[model samples]
Target: MKKIILYLMSAMLMVSLAACTPTQPKMETTPPDPQVMASTGGASDKVPDPNAEPMEIISVYSKNDNKTGLNQAMDAVDKLTAEAMVSKLIEYGVLEEGTKVLKYESADGIGTLDLSAVPQSGSGDDKLTIAAIGNTFIENFELDKLKLLVNGKNYSSGSIKQGDNDYLEYVKNYKEIK
Candidate 1:
């Protein structure tokens, strides 16, 4: 009788221990916001102004060329071209409503465009702005190279190193603008 009771008690204890062990919790993942995901519907989001001003390209004939003369000429041309391009884009509704051209200049065969524009209300992406600015200048400029500078320095990669920020640097060849 003692042996049987002991056996029963051991079995009961084992059963209780097994029941007390915790099970893996189910992972709960909520789906992304529907409104955010549904914002971009189709190809219209990627279209830019076809007649926007071309990208400005400065040319340095030689490594020993006069930097001041080259910069002055490039700056004059860049200012005009940038203004025209931004105006055209805005007129065609390709740019956002409040978008505007803040300034532009070229130095030693490098043109930098500064814009005070933001994506449209529903666009939610600045890719179109980037494409438009790069492509338009490349198409309109004589040289095949340029750089984009926001504020007072280069925004991305190119030949010019305006400052010391990694993500802010955007470099591209003129042929690669399209």
Candidate 2:
């Protein structure tokens, strides 16, 4: 009787221990819906749309920095803006005989740019260059507004200092794009 009782208790304990053990999460083996799968095509089907509108790059000008003076910031801005402009021009195939950007007024969180010094290349690279230049201007200037002009004419949208809407849209539509 003692032996039988001991055996029963051991079996009960074993059963309780087995019950307490956690079950593994189930793996998904079945393929997704055929219609959804067809729409996606394959893993490498994602590509950037050329027809999509490019994101706008906002210009950021500096107001005041205690650590770095406005002069230092302005100097940095000059260098960066020049480089960006050059790069954009080159990318847009608009390299001309005498293309230069002169600083008209840059102070108190405002940058007045003069492009009259730049010769007309007519390379159709202006748009590409402007995008690059605008993006660069925004990144380095830290200013509130950057006014762009071509040959002393206000050709572009007045300010490149706003936030990037395209980037935000991209982030939001990532799932759809993917």
| lDDT digits (tens) for residues 25-73 of candidate 2 | 9998999877656555665677877987655343332212231211111
- Which candidate achieves the best TM-score against the true structure? 1
**Model 1 alpha-carbon drift over 4 Å, by segment:** 1-80, 120-125, 151-178
Please write out the lDDT profile of model 1 over residues 35-91, one tens digit for every residue. Answer: 657657577567677987655444211111321111111222344366666665555
| TM-score, prediction 1 | 0.36
lDDT of 2 at 62: 21
Q: Count the backbone clashes (under 3 Å) in each candidate.
A: 12, 12
Question: Which portions of model 2 miss their true places by more than 4 Å?
Answer: 1-97, 117-127, 156-178
